[model samples]
Target chain A: MLARRVIPCLDVDKGRVVKGTKFVNLTDEGDPAELAERYAREGADEIVFLDITAAHEGRATMLDVVRRTASRAFVPLTVGGGVRSVQEMHDVLRAGADKVSFNTAAVAAPELLTACAERFGSQAVVCAIDARRLPRTDGAGQTWEVVTHGGRRATDLDAVSWALRVVELGAGELLVTSIDRDGTRSGFDTELLASIASRVRVPVIASGGASSPEDFVTAVRDGKADAVLAASIFHRRMHSIASVKAAMAAAGLPVRPVGEAVA
Target chain B: MTGSKPRIAILDYGAANLVSITHGLAAVGADVVVAAEPSALAGADALVVPGVGAAASAMTHLRERGLVEPLRNWVRAGKPCLGICLGFELLFDASDEGDAETLGFLAGRTVALRDAPTLPHIGWNVVRAVRPHPLFDGIPDGSYFYFVHSFAPVPADEGVVVARTDHGRPFVSAVARGSLYGLQFHPEKSSDAGLRLLSNFLRLVAANAETNARAGAALGSEVA
Candidate 1:
């Protein structure tokens, strides 16, 4: 059986990690590499860095940050935010990102998904979907509408249908994030996750609104997520990854112990 | 044979994760080189065929660089070699992926994993070493390693299979025959278990070199 992965996400801006990432052991609080290395030591199965910088010059700086982080952390790194072109994807992967997540770019041009998957393998392409539940205009109960550009813009694309198309377009992994439940600390939108997980054949990573260890359990058990990704919960020191892994293990889930996999 | 550092050549055929593999090798104190030309691999103490792309493209890249025959000869001579992921798939005769013709170093056919609940089989899964080998020297059985692939090789000879894992059903996770080694999992990205596996490979290369040196010295002494 595959072990359920626990990932800690860092929101980076101008080559610096932002959003209250003030862990004590870290020498440079702004440095993404130091934070990533700390997370790796804490047994984060993977680390994601979302570069929120919008400037052209800032993108190069983010790539440098990515290169440094990749050198420091041995685990798989997934970099997203402002990834619009295949050249940018190549630059990130060449800087040592194992996978590149495309949300805004993928929605704008669905063929970009196919193109990147062709240049790089599908395993290198991660289709990140940010969805928000909306009241069904068609007399139905509700529907998860796909949103892009940091969840500010909504599209007509249905969440479930988009997931199937991305998989068909050769995306190896699907990262479904719920915009409504994000940073709410309420819990994961397992309903959103369950809908996508059932439709896609690739590994689904449930992101946003992960407040508790049980929330992770629900994400895996009820939502059927292959992995759970969180930002503020782990970054704010609410719970350590080891404690979460322990809780998951107690709940009869398989997890890798920190520092035990190495010699 | 002459230097203290073990020269390990990682065959570069436009593989995606070349940087990580090189970094993993560097962590184990092995001198790593990314060889695009076949000549660069000739003097290597061990050759690693690191791959991450599709089968047909991987084959095309290797052929374009004129590396097919040299890799075949290297394996035939029984020098230490290792393959990772798509590199492992390329060791077989053929693959269902793009109808690719592989190196055929191992007598097997690579096919799509049957009844897979997931397509790529991503994430970490336990791999159990079925037979004792130096490749798994310090690693424990049923240890988790990261794997990302839809196709797996079915070796013609079962004896080559040293480790087995399952995503949907049981499949060959690691195969070893003398100096030739292949692993479907990515040891570089697998955290500690992965580093340990790469460390073990480095040790194997050193051990193989020492044995060959001793044999050569003895033969020279007899001739003298």
Candidate 2:
């Protein structure tokens, strides 16, 4: 059986980690590679580098960061952000990323996903869907609208349908983020997750609003997420990855023990 | 052969990503070369065939680069060779995915993982050793390694099987026969356990080179 992955996401901008973290042992905590290595040592199943760099020049720096991260951290890496073309995705993969996620660009031009998937396998293509809960109207139980640019803009597309569309468009995986619950620490939007995850054939990674280890359990049990991703909790040392896995393991979820996979 | 690092040729058919695998081989103290041409396999102690995506297209790329025969010859010559992921699938006779005939170094065929809950089976999964081998020297049985594929090979020769991992059902994860090795998992992306496996492979290649050298010296002649 596949072990449910517990991933720590780092927001990178211009080759540096966006969120400030102060680890006691490291000299340069801002360096994405150093932090990623630390997280891997702490038993992060995989590392997600969300390259939020806005400027064009910063893209090169992110590639360097990916290179440095790959050299230091031997874990699977997925880089998302600013990848618009097949060539750009190629650059990230050549820079040592195992997978690349598409968000805004994928929404604008969905054929990008197919083209990228054809060049690189669908296994290497990931579609990140940011969704926000829409208010109940006409006695509807629940609904979500697709959002882009970090949940600032909303598209007319329904989140559930969009997920299926992306998969059909050749996305191997879906990173479903709840814009409504992002950074809220309330919990994951299980309703939103279930809607898409249950429908799509690809694995769905639940993102946003993860504060505790139990939240991860619910994400899988309720949302039916194949993997769970969180940022601040692991970053701020609020909770250790071991604790999260312990919680999951206690809940009868299969999890890889930290520091046990290595010799 | 005693102290010198082993040279490895990683066949690049262009589409498959070679970054992590290349860095991984180098990190394991093996001199790495991303060889795109048949002549690039020269002077290398071992060859690594790393690929992903469709078998037909992958086979096409190898054919276009004129690497098909050399790869088969390299394995037929019994030089140390390792194939990762799709490269593992290509070891078989044919694939159901692309309906394409692959390199039949081993007797088998690639098929969709039976009863798989997930299509891609993308994540860390436990690889249980069916038999002991030097490739798993330091790695423990049931250790998790990163995997990203939907199809797995059913080996015709069960004697070559080294490890089996279950996603839906038990599937061959690692195989070893003579100097040939095939892993369905990506050691390059498997973190620590992965690096250790690659290190062990390097050691295996180095040891084989030594054994060959000693045999040549006993014959009182160098084959080359």
Candidate 3:
């Protein structure tokens, strides 16, 4: 009876929180630490801070941000994007991040996942897979391909198959993002999510397209996802964590109630 | 220090998450200390073992710090002790992760949850009590606990297993024997259910102290 998690993702650029529409045309939201504290106080189960500027700057500012946020957040914080080396991962953990996520680094080296998992426990390592659906090339088939570099580069790797590989490499969780449906506010791709969840035994965190609390419920109930991550709905004040939990409860999904009241 | 707050020592074997564990215990009003020295464990009315990482590495750290025998002696002396996650696995005789040897205080072996419906069993799942234990006191039957592990201990003695959770099959989730209690879930991360469990654990510590005082008084009277 673990409650399903409702995560709010913060895209950080130049040490500030920013929200982009369709992964472009970014608009500054607020200070990263302030936003994180607000979400934590509002009952967010966990907070994800992505250093979108890491790749461009060739360095990570997320660690400092993580340290400042961790000092006050009082909840689990996951820092991702541009985490390329073991040193970087270690720095993030030392900065008080409960978990460190990898994107380009994990795909490029692959063994980096195993190394990180070995040095730091698997529970500390998360593999973020950005995927997009591709048209059938073999005459009567359609599939999703794993994309890297902020969903710009498309690899021949199948999303489901790569998910299994990463788990085998000792990834504790899979953060699967559907590039096709990202920021659409249309809801998660239920079929795609279910397919991935059925393939892997690790917890699947559905990301990319979530407009309503119903989207979260669908992702957990039908998609069988352990949690759901949303940016737009949460960033734009479209929904709150309390409302999402209420909706999930109404949908018959077991969710942790707000406030501390022992059951 | 009588009638004052009972001092709780959290054994830091170099590989555990002491910060979070200490924070959680403090949130419940427990006087918590991250004890790294053998002498610190001496005056504690209760002990907490919080761990992360491989079994072999954890054991190595414990042994290097001369904590193995002291921990066993503390529990044997009937001091209340609670182990969380990796701490639970370390209480077993052996683990499949890395090396086979373990603390061997508990009669069980830790095996990988490979064939389980889900590996790593992350997030929350309802834990059902199979036996009556003080740890589950005041908590409901199907209370959920937060878990994140790929391996769990299966105690040899069925009576020692206090709770079981079904991920694919019903497996042991919590265990209690005498004063030694271990939880496979991260109670610090388990929300209210976790806080209630910690409260019950504190009660057990108080009860143990009272029993110890009575025994000491009886011994003194016998000498007289």
Docking class of 3: acceptable
Q: What class would a CAPRI assessor give candidate 1's docking? A: medium
lDDT of each residue in A104-204, candidate 2, tens digit only:
99999999999998888899999999999888899677889999988878899999999999999899999999988888899999999999988987899
Clashes within 3 Å, all models in order: 3, 0, 4
Residue A77 of model 1, lDDT score:
91
B127-218: candidate 2 lDDT, tens digit per residue: 99999999998898899999999899999999999999998799999999999999999999888889999999999999999998888797
TM-score of candidate 3 versus the correct structure, residues matched by position: 0.86
- Badly placed stretches (over 4 Å) of model 2 are A20-29, A261-263, B1-3, B221-224
DockQ winner: 2
Q: Is candidate 1 or candidate 3 better by TM-score?
A: 1
Per residue, candidate 1 scores C-alpha lDDT tens digits across A8-71 of 9998878888884222232224689999989988899999998777687898898888788776
In angstroms, the error of model 1 at B209 is: 0.8
Ranked by DockQ from best down, the candidates are 2, 1, 3
Positional deviation of residue A16's Cα in model 2 after best superposition, in angstroms: 0.5
The weakest ten consecutive residues by lDDT in model 1 chain B span B1-10
Q: Write candidate 3's Cα lDDT for A107-208 as tens digits.
A: 888999999888778888899999899887876555789999877898889888898899899788999898888877788987778888988877889998
lDDT of each: 0.88, 0.90, 0.81
| Candidate 2 vs. true structure, TM-score | 0.96
The list of candidate 3 runs beyond 4 A from truth reads A1-4, A12-45, A53-76, A94-96, A138-140, A246-260, B1-3, B213-224
Please tell me which predicted candidate would have the highest lDDT against the true structure.
2
Cα displacement (Å) at residue A8, model 1: 0.8
